[model samples]
Target: MATTTGTAAPELTGLPLLGSLLDLKNDSLGTFLRARRDHGDVVRISAGPPGLRATVYGVFSAEGAQQVLAGESANFRKDNAFYQEVRESFGNGLLTSQDEDYRRQRRLVQPLFTRRRVDGYAAAIATEVTTLAEEWRQADAGTVDVLQDMARLALRAVARILFGTDVDAAVEIVEKNFPDVGAYVLRRGYSPVNVPRDWPTPGNRRAAAVHRALYEVCDRIIAERRSSGAAPGDGQDLLSLLVEAESAEDGSFDATELREQVLVFLLAGHETTATSLGFALHLLALHPEERKRAHEEVDRVLAGRTPGAGDLDALPYVTRVLKEAMRLFPAAPVIGRRAVAATVVGGVAIPAGADVIVAPWVTHRHPDYWEDAERFDPDRFTPEAEAARPRYAWFPFGGGPRACIGQHFSMLESVIALAMLLQRYDLEAVDTVVPVASAITLQAAGPARCRLTPRNP
Candidate 1:
């Protein structure tokens, strides 16, 4: 155990009473970056007023991130206000579950996400990307919103993979309600004070309605699956595998647990990948040299054929492009955890019960670990380069026991989608400077419009 040097971490100065609340709300990413820039890697940020004030111990260095997320992860738990808000809105799925529940969920879901299993879904990903490529090729308007389009594609692909024959129903419900649900989670997650959810407040009411609808849809899907009599571990889709999963000691997820897991998969499965894909395309469009290199790589490896899991390794440059994009715009920019005990990270003492945040948004750009960090450079991810950096420096999918189970799945989907898209189109950025905000995920605050010209046209 590392001993604290009795030194207190520097605090970010903020306005009277509200502290950094307005700044955080208006520009969280900027505020975090500024915190790291003005102060050192470990800085204290306070928000809200006196009694209701929420103070976060912001860990901005790769070393600190490693300690909080992997080294001393037990000391840093997911019981923070942000996670509570997520659990209330999204249910205690693996993403929000803790301790024994998380352990059990991980054991059950881990087998379903093995490399071989995730690779099998590449066909589904290719199918969806190909479909979108065709739609883009045939569209009357040459320009499209990359973020919105990729979101649709990711949702459709994941839904199909998860639900198999029943994808249409799941996709429709998620597409319709997720935006609002995400908004609600973000609003309440950051707010210093929130009214009782039962108070019939507009936000509360809207959240409840969306939650009910989402739950009902998931429950209906599970019921249909059960009615079909699909045996455990026998069905092709993920939902079937989950439905059938069981343990002699732990048993399997009940209907409610199934619904929660499904909702979590739907939310996490699409959004993060969409953010990566959209940004990769946008970045490639802005940098023609990078785009051309990507196109060449895609053209060579794919040879005008659809990409699959095998091509993932074959197209290293394309993968790097996605990696670089993730570094610049990681989907989960700030990951929050509550400290269970007093701890020292990066030589700064963090007291027990502190709201600790390990921000990839800042760590990925940490000057000590990255040179020209803000620039989009895929070569930074070359095997040699990556091995040289601290493991947590570029952690877009997070770290520790709670790292994303869908890491492989997300990579496969992004690589396949990018390779296929690059193989089919010549991209140009119509909205060159895309404004972004940190919500539940990194979001495009403005339109990320790109002009797609068909390659063979």
Candidate 2:
């Protein structure tokens, strides 16, 4: 971090403000690593909001990521300069809330995301994946958009598991509104002067309109479930639990609280998984051997028929492949923190109010911690190989107290989905995709075109 303490400085690219922002906007990871290599691990740049400066670190060491995540309160706050941009879209939900609000909501949702609880949903999750694969199989052979397919499938899975409903209408609502939330929050850091929430700008108004529509849909779902008395015959789903969740202080969650939780889980839980699964498939297709080996692992573990909860562990190869894919292309990609007080990380002074982003994409691929860095190697995730790697070398789902609560759920879904897909079909990328880095999750700059075909193994 460049400070006025007369400390020696390292070289940096771009000019002062524009360089960091340009590098970040263009290629997030590249800019950071390139900066780190030129300046140092702890480099300070004047980007982001006015009062908020950015301190970038290439924290590939697992211990570091763990510490940051575990020590979230001491070192960070989620509702920082950039996060405010997305608040209208996300509300005071778990993912975007700060301090005590985060803790309270996390408690309510914690029990539901337990490994055992998530395990119960494994079959259902895999069933959704299999169902989607079968749908793709039924489609005429040609360029299939894996990203779009996975997004819809993931949305439906969450809708069923969390909301206890088919995503039929939810899809239209999300398709129409999801972007509004992201665009409202993400594009150029938010400010009262420019991207004002109250402004009648077409974009802002559209985002606001979507916000109202989403809550309206959630209200209807809650009303329907309440009116029906949530009869026991239908399969168990997330909506049932949410509707039934017993609050710690209060007896139960109120309508307003439930609305935010549903939206949070619906978006946070599913969108990320979709991007990740799609990225996994994309990477697997590029490396045929990895794909074949992953397919073999699924075959050996599950053979024929559907994969169940217990089968997830038996499919470690599938897990490794998934982890390796996430390592290479983390869906969320970056985790940002705002320093609560003046502190030093790697001997750099982090001014209070500064925005510190620990970019997983840069750290995951850092040569300081990874060999080859760019190659697809599931072997790296083998227990022994992982033991040799730094703790933060991988943060696809992030780490620490504020880390993704739905990590277990997402992983199970991914492993089972990948196993089921590879066992029954083969896929390969079609045209080159221009990777786009936006949304709550990372997606192809353009839709990922792929040729999906039935596989025999």
Candidate 3:
């Protein structure tokens, strides 16, 4: 059913069954690598559609991804089946919304991620990471799952920067309904039809309940902040900004809309940061020279003091290593887009309603684009070397009009956090590490256990 960019449909082999099994096995990246090796840049597979089938292709090529994300952006929409799967968990959130709604919502929220705003958030990020690191220092040292710790860290930063100082309690609120929200997607077996919460299975029931909890907590924060009459754009935290950030055209978000915005921040923000941070640490630990360089950069730039906003941009080597780490193991490893209208991209005809997956994991490692593509080499991103490479070859945060809105904030936050940890601690995988891929993000299967010894006196 699937056809190449050229008019000729690929000769049907056993791929329909083979591809289906590989995908159902949930090793999507592995499947992509196989196809890229078997076919060229463009590979077509039967996805059970009648006329049009999904295309598994590369986006790591700087020119190729740019064309899809920027040049021909109008042809794409975020409303793909993959995103639709999580519709209940994130209804109209920025990551999945389409067209006019997406634009309006994005415009309303853009101010939160501006350089000035994110720069101000430096102290908050530094303080949070320091507190967490201090607590870790006080604990018995052996192995720690940096994933959970990083998740908590990113969430707390969100609390201070987005929800104000009150984000700690909301974690439980999200946990309550997060289960059923997944049944809408992650159920061992699930039905799409909406059954009443009470009548729904336990997972669905929990999903509905947790969803309410999320809304209520958001509602409370919005109500409290609005009632306080805080100064407009004070940048106290995210909740206040949502209450105050007025678009030049629409004025400001309604209370109902603000709730959706909070949910958007919660869903879009945390996991990606956490996953990247963990993988960065994993890479540094596995590649000790890079870890030492990152540490030395932090030490040279900030001395022994905690890193602040000013220190981030100056920590060039640290950022490069982190960039390489992300390039090797991008947090949002795979991103999919569907064509809402027929379009031509990479000189290939993309028909309307076909799924387009541009995987950073596969593309970032494409042999043609990178030297020693599989090895960990942070120096490859050095300024001179970067200039030599094509532009879209390494997009950890993606690019173009619909690119990640929080790109700056996330980078600032990530750099600061990594500096804090590297200054004092060394971490690694205790045993062989196996990465597990899921509907949204990539996670290491076991505890990233490692001996965390204090730097020599």
lDDT of 3 at 357: 68
Instruction: Give the residue spans of candidate 3 off by over 4 A.
Output: 1-5, 9-19, 48-60, 175-183, 186-202
- Spell out the clash pairs found in candidate 1: 232-244
Taking all chains together, the TM-score of candidate 3 against the true structure is 0.89
Candidate 1 backbone overlaps, count: 1
TM for every model, in the order presented, reads 0.98, 0.90, 0.89
Error of 3 at 263 (Å): 1.3
For model 1, the local distance difference test gives 0.90
Candidate 1 per-residue C-alpha lDDT over 316-378 given as tens digits, one digit per residue, 9 for 90 to 100? 999999999999999999999999888788778999889999999999999998998889899
Arranged by TM-score, best first: 1, 2, 3
Better of 1 and 3 by lDDT: 1
| lDDT at position 58, candidate 2 | 40
What TM-score does structure 2 among the candidates reach? Answer: 0.90
Clashing pairs in 3: 62-392, 162-238, 177-210, 180-207, 181-207
Give candidate 1 regions above 4 Å deviation.
none
Maximum-lDDT candidate = 1
Off by over 4 Å in 2: 1-11, 16-19, 48-64, 188-195, 231-235, 247-251, 432-434
